[model samples]
Target: MALSLCCAWISILLLLLPSLSHGGKLLVVPMVGSHWLSMQEVVEKLSERGHEVVVLVPEVSWQMETTQAYKVVTHPVSQTLEELDNSFQEYVAVHLTQKPFPLNALAMYNTSVHVFNSFFGQCKDLFRSQETLRFLNQSGFDALLTDPAFMCGTILAHHLSLPFVFFMRGFPCNLHFAAPQCSSPLSYVPRLFSFNSDHMTFFQRVENTLISLLELDYCNGFYGEALKLSSEVLQRDVSLMDLVNSAAIWILRFDFVFEYVRPVMPNMVFVGGINCAKKKPLPKEIAPSLLNCGHAISLHNVCELEGWDFSFLFQISLMLFDRLMESPLNLINKAKNNILNKNIRIKLYLRHSITSGPRRVGAGLRFKRQILAGSTI
Candidate 1:
């Protein structure tokens, strides 16, 4: 009887183990902007695994009700959506017109700081609220998962004395924050606003260095105002940058294949392509062209081309060969010989929006042609 009772107790404990291990309240604070679906999925997955999640959002797109899994706490701000739209438009306009005038670096930095200042300032009530602060302090959250794009979340985590983790839902541009300060070499890695590729000419490297300096300047320009606001809310002087640097881990939404090769810190992790789904079958119209195609080249990161253009190129291999004639001209010459013998096999895989298609083709024509044109075979 004693042995049987002990076995039954063991079985009961096995069933209870999962719930006990995962029973912790998690708090997620995302940047107040569009395209937050990635973070929402993270919250949902945690809730599904028996962890209670509480997400503080600027706007509640769905009805908020307490369930066994999660809850939503909404704090709507006063700024209209129109104001957000206008600010983004102004930023774009400044970037487009920056090329003609000299001293564009200073011009762009001033514009960028102004834009983010207005946007982040609008959320002061959400971050600096006495009521919100009190609620968060008493909520017994285990840890915080937040985006570092806006430093308010970092400030809140510091105020609440909670360890913070980063979940960057967009491109990973803030490598300087993740790595040791000034560790990321400005010689090759492009700035967020700079449209240059990882490979750079000597002059391009100099331009990239200048752009990076401006980015650092713009990011730190509004620190005084941010520090003042956060200190008043926390009831103590806090170093916001220090709080950000103390992150337990940073999850980036990028793939190594798409990014330039660079050293990353141990605390930094990549969970890229989290949103990608299984590929569907190609449509009937496009299927035939690729069926018996010879060697194909996939250009990664070219601008979007019309679907019809792809089909047309595949239909006539000769026309496709024509496209390669300008750059990689030797490839075209080789391709002509292969076509005559009916055994051409070249496959090109183009990556997504690295730059404009024309510029890529133009650059290729300039460089690859000269080198290959001199080759004997």
Candidate 2:
């Protein structure tokens, strides 16, 4: 009878063991705007996988909506949403309107400094909230996830002495590679904004080298205020590299198909197509149009094409399409006439991924091949 009772107790303990342990607790500090959108995907997935997720957001923000997937903690910020929006708009306006290289570069630098200053001000306000800081310190979070572009999360993670992961498309001045000690040779690896392909000419390589050299100064200027604020918060001398170098992992939103080949570290993970993981059925209004169209072209409005005439390009595209069609000459003529007479419906599908130059060109070529093979867009 004693042996049987002991066996029964052991079986009960085994059954309850699984339920006794719980998923890890994660704290996420995401940046504003589109950056938050990408990070939110990961946050929700972690929650679904049984981990406890807590997201920190400013009281006033753009696109940081409350969701059931994770617990959101709002902290007081000094800057208002209107002020943030206006600064961002000013930066975008400068980027889009200024075309001359030297003029545009100077304008971009000035506007970016203004924007960074405003963001740093918000970071300072977060640190001032003792209640929020106390809560975070006592939360007993297993790890931290954040976007380093904003710098606030990284600073907080360091302050709390938590191992953190970085989620981003890329960092300004190649900080992503540099902070992680990843190899990035300038000979073929292009610097950001250099617009150089992997196959570089002699002169292009030289330009790439020069740009790489200038990146240090640019980064310092861009993050000067941020570095100072970080030191003040930590109560010690600190640099951007110090804050980022100790990251446990980096989740980069990059794919080889769209990005040039480059060396990466083991801790750096490339989840390029993570944004496309969630699939939804096409809307009723857009689905039929895609199926019925003979050919479709998507134009993303990244910035204003000041002098380019899109209508003429549309006509040219249609003409090329007509030539590429392997149909009877009579059928081809009839189709061309019908398309022209029907005014050639042009639909613009603006997606975040299409913003990159290589991806945009690759998508256009893929669409062209699809159309030639008698497939709908």
For this target, which candidate reaches the highest TM-score against the unseen true structure? 2
Model 1, C-alpha of 212: deviation from truth (Å): 4.3
In the range 1-377, model 1's lDDT, one tens digit per residue, is 99999999999988878553556888888765433555666777888878888888665222233445568776756766666666655665565453543456556656676666766764586774567767888999999988766666777787788898888843224543433343556777777656678788898888888866665445556455566777786787755456567888888766655666766778777777574322234447644664444444443322233232432334344334334322232221112111111211233323244443322111111112222222221
Which candidate gets the maximum lDDT versus the true structure? 2
Residue pairs of candidate 2 with colliding backbone atoms: none
117-196 in candidate 2: lDDT tens per residue? 98778888889999999999999999999998878889999899999999988777888889888778889798866777
Clashing residue pair totals per candidate (backbone < 3 A): 19, 0
Q: What is the C-alpha RMSD of each candidate to the true structure, in Å?
A: 11.8, 10.0
The lDDT for every candidate, in the order shown, is 0.59, 0.73
lDDT of the structure predicted as candidate 2: 0.73
* Error of model 1, residue 221, in angstroms: 1.3
State residue 253's C-alpha deviation in candidate 1, in Å: 1.0
